[model samples]
Target chain A: FATMAPSSSPVHLLFRQLFEKESSTYTYLLADLAHPDKPAVLVDPVDQTVDRDLNLVKQLGLKLIYAMNTHVHADHITGTGLIKKQMPNVRSLISRASCAKADIFVDPGEKIHVGNLLLEVRPTPGHTAGCVTYVTGEGEGQPYPRMAFTGDALLIRGCGRTDFQGGDAHELYKSVHTQIFSLPRETLLYPAHDYKGQTVTTVGEEILHNPRLSKDEESFNTIMENLGLAYPKMFDVAVPANMVCGIQDSHA
Target chain B: FATMAPSSSPVHLLFRQLFEKESSTYTYLLADLAHPDKPAVLVDPVDQTVDRDLNLVKQLGLKLIYAMNTHVHADHITGTGLIKKQMPNVRSLISRASCAKADIFVDPGEKIHVGNLLLEVRPTPGHTAGCVTYVTGEGEGQPYPRMAFTGDALLIRGCGRTDFQGGDAHELYKSVHTQIFSLPRETLLYPAHDYKGQTVTTVGEEILHNPRLSKDEESFNTIMENLGLAYPKMFDVAVPANMVCGIQDSHA
Candidate 1:
């Protein structure tokens, strides 16, 4: 059986995976192409690429509805605030647990929709206390295979570092096992950042090959503890700015 | 009308857009997931990222039948030769007009198929005499709106520099106007490279917004001539290596 409906289906969804070079972040643009208005949502947008992203949304004639973050990022500022400023009609969204400023704050199990397309928010806090995975195909029956936008919780072949931002390796391991891995084996997993050029991975691939998360919980926690990673260069500037949806002092 | 079939269709195609950071080149992986064996093809692979590409193919349990190039790239070494060397069963492919060494040389109007998915070759030479665009959804009632893998001939809001490697402004103008702009308005265009992190654009969007291509032929040519862009940093090493399918002196 096919994992998702064909592009010719009655209710087709338009999807694009955009990249931010500076932070190696992946932002996703999605909408119901079948809808008359083409209402769209952007997930994990970076502040630096706001112009490029907004221009694209305009070029495609998509109505920008939401600029959302999977978590409060420490590596790069979120584009949500900047986006809302330029387009006041646009709303900023973040997990309620994130304690961040946004027009809309969602909690675990909440369903966010633009047209018929939906994102089911699942808390997957590991890399950060408020990180969440946005899984597609929630609510009634959506034929598409679920896609997990695993913010910093799960990465390709690796999980995010759990050294700061209230990160807990144990929680992350549990989150992935319960919320992400349990999806259908074909569920496509897109991470927020990738140092390598890889764009996407699948649940089956990660289950069999994820170097860190595939290990037992104890080993996974131990691995996360000894990563010896450096503090993120942009942490100081990014976190505070992102706390208020990336407006920073300039907005004041 | 939807641009392509939805993902759940009986003959759903699996697609992933991979990036190479140094050159901002985009490599596309395509396969017919509906086929039991899942034969796959990679377009415009880069040598520096061959390991990641091959590993992905293996991870997906895809049998990669061909490694092809849209043109002999001047910006980076083509991964075709290296890919074939690693997977002997995989054939290297390039355009016959490109004067490049490859196991399979395709010409305009030819169709290459892996399972039921197809790429209809369209000569889009401009950046170079051999450049071609691989357009999907060709032949016999393929319901998907066509997608053009336009290599350097047309980029998002831009076109490739027409200053070297047999570059010709006039030819590019004519090629895109006749072969690309004429496609269905909703057809998606995937370029070989994008520096600004854009993943894709539709025919309608590019037709109206491409700064150079949207202008008259004479004006377009003038702009191309005056780009004043620096010669590509990799031109010296990339051109010769790409000519022989990216296996440098070491491959011998």
Candidate 2:
């Protein structure tokens, strides 16, 4: 019912389809060609699975302007380097707080401009110390940012675990309460991974019903303790792989 | 409630825990001192995760003997090489018909002596091409297989996807109906991974009531289609990794 909005610009905004691979890591490409350059952004791409992303970019005839990672991933390899390797002109960006070295370290309050769209970086460090959410739209006095890219910080029915490196449950609580849940009810929520079948959700819906973050602190701690998820086997490999913009060194 | 068994040998059995850094692949070591001079058999070993496996073997005061892979994995990297590296005296054994290359190939009807136990290899290639289940018990006339390492062929309340390489619904039908179902119903089913809060199941229970495999062919196809799982991202990496016994050239 909320998918009734028409593009504000007559040039048309085309969002190439985005989805997760077998590992449940979500990747997205957003583009608007109304302006001169027709810039686009690739979000949370997975390593070695860049063929689809590249193919989509070519089919859409859009210029790759920015490649961004929401945070370091635990389950799969990141594709930040692969994109930059294929598209040399695109800038690779990640949060400054993230321990991984990046070409462009983004500040929490910094604004990134691509074509006419503006992405406001909101440091939401609960799932990990460097976790961030990209709010898309006009930073001030505009209803444009209709969506947010929430990496491991949030999910449709749950939130990211705070047991990994630099992960803190308390920080996650603050992030959801202050930064993410503060968004407008109509804002669309797009996460980096969704193990469940559903892909997207609304800010209002998540704020009111997210199983982990919406509950009291006691319940939240209990949930975290009871998760019992085995440490991802690839964590050691994936963390370092993502540190340098998702590049897999031929030699480990 | 089915974990009742009686044994006469004073053999000390040790289990070593090896974790895959990618896709959380877990390899285990089960050894018995009764056959100290002979080689021990490794189960579901991953490529890079063998340090702990070897360390545990030495710490338990046993010698390395053999390596075994339950099936070609689609999730984590394999560790067959690491085992060989640590103990060159150890011979790697896998299903003879499996796509993997091994030092020693085992047939379905063949049985290997491990300490006081007899290990029987059962060709249950439904989860992947050459997938096999290992049944271990003491003595030749044992009434039941004390333990069954089912790999991905049979999971509690679920079955492996019949969509990947060598994954065939019809083949899975036969594997479940004729091969695995014929085993003693009381045999313990030990799967490779379990994410749904389940750790174990029995052969009798699965054969009698598994919702997916127990259904007729038409219903099974519809269920597989509707499940709509994407192909694993690690399929390419995992296949190649498992091919040479989970070893990738450091420079690969």
Candidate 3:
């Protein structure tokens, strides 16, 4: 539907996509207009990029309110715990189903408030039991939120595997078809990790071209079973640290 | 003259070059074939690459005995502290002139013994107050040492900046010429960091091709002063952490 956006829209929302190349992770910063100091959320902040992220926040004159994650990561340590130390008031949030402790436990069908913006959280588990999709704005309403932070549940042309942690192919397949594909065909998808330099994909494009998920149930499950994915290099350190929201030690 | 390297050369040292792309830093691992389990020294291990360094040691089935740094680094945290934790027997080493704390403080003209392999330490300051060049071999003649680990004092074709942390252009010029260049013309030079992919350079090549240091003191100082280099991103965290051998906290 967005064949051509308005020449300019003051209410379009502030968004920035930052890349931490070490782990191929993308961190997103979002804020509503009219309040430069209040950025509603940050998604998937990596540990090594904490300084970079903090500098970006300062550069944009944002008071970061939420340092959140879609799920516990396995490739790199999360910056959630560290960000809290810097932004003391910013809540570190993760899905309660993850059972990975955080300052705030969010669940499906919840609304996260940031200034005039509202992120509707939808549980899109399958990559991990706690994976989530954060949708910005109201799809059919006056606000017209068209973007979705799909975490690791869905990528540009491929979906995350069901091999590590509590990943399940059946749950993942059902989740994508139900919660994600049900969104308006125009909704934009932003995945957590993209090694291939792909940035964004529209719901319509993914529905028509997503090879893994666009197939039948048996074919999708079989494909997930045979991906033969390699465990991440820093899994030993990343998972445990991410469980506590990126705290490397007990003192944190 | 390596016209034909011997099939069974006991005196030959096994060398591997590892790159940590985050900081464009290169860490070298050297092990003498005579006593593989005795002493293997690692140069410039980055904190994030600790696991990688240790894994390389294990993969080669060699025992690590020393973690050495030519000078305190500014770009990335050193893995010396973390390496000590993993390889309890590995001694942390640095130039005594550095005044930086380490398990072993080496001095100029001293010999760092690794089985039959002898690494002669030569004071090569100026990039930092306590930089040193380690020339592997030639303590007892036969199998002449032709390699010098010049650290940041002498890069492939350019020397390090003399702007921060007690860097001196004049001192660096003299040090490179006297301590590093004075080595055998065939001496192989290994640097601490390389932004480009170029790895090893011979002293003979550097003398002719080094753009920054192959000139008189007045011209060298003038060029150094006008380079206008940027401060490293991890300067604060890295310098302090490296001083303490990459220890981020009490737990480390």
Candidate number achieving the greatest DockQ relative to the actual structure: 1
Instruction: List, residue by residue over B49-80, the lDDT tens digit for candidate 2.
Output: 56755654664456667788888778877677
Model 3 alpha-carbon miss at residue B70, Å: 0.7
- How does candidate 2 fare on TM-score? 0.48
Candidate 1 lDDT by residue in tens digits, B1-252: 145453323456788888999899999999877666798999999988999999988877899999999998999998987887898999889899999888899999998877777788999988999999999865454436778899999998899988888889999999999999999998989999999988888888888999999999989988987888887889898999989886574448
Error of 3 at B31 (Å): 0.3
lDDT of 3 by residue, A5-102 (tens): 32222343656666677787778888764444555578998888888678756754677888999999988999998888877888889999988989
Task: Give candidates' CA RMSD values in order.
Answer: 4.8, 19.1, 18.6
Error of 3 at A151 (Å): 35
Residue A71, candidate 1: how far off, in angstroms?
A: 0.4
Instruction: Assess every candidate by TM-score.
Output: 0.92, 0.48, 0.50
Off by over 4 Å in 1: A1-11, A139-143, A250-252, B1-10, B139-143, B250-252
Model 3 lDDT per residue over B1-252, tens place:
244333223454666666677787878888775553545889988887888678757755688888999899988888998888877888889998987889899989998877557788998889898899888866443244367888899997788888988899889999999998887876778889766444566787678768888788899999999998887789998888888765555473
In model 3, the Cα lDDT at residue B75 comes to 84
Clashes of each: 15, 15, 0
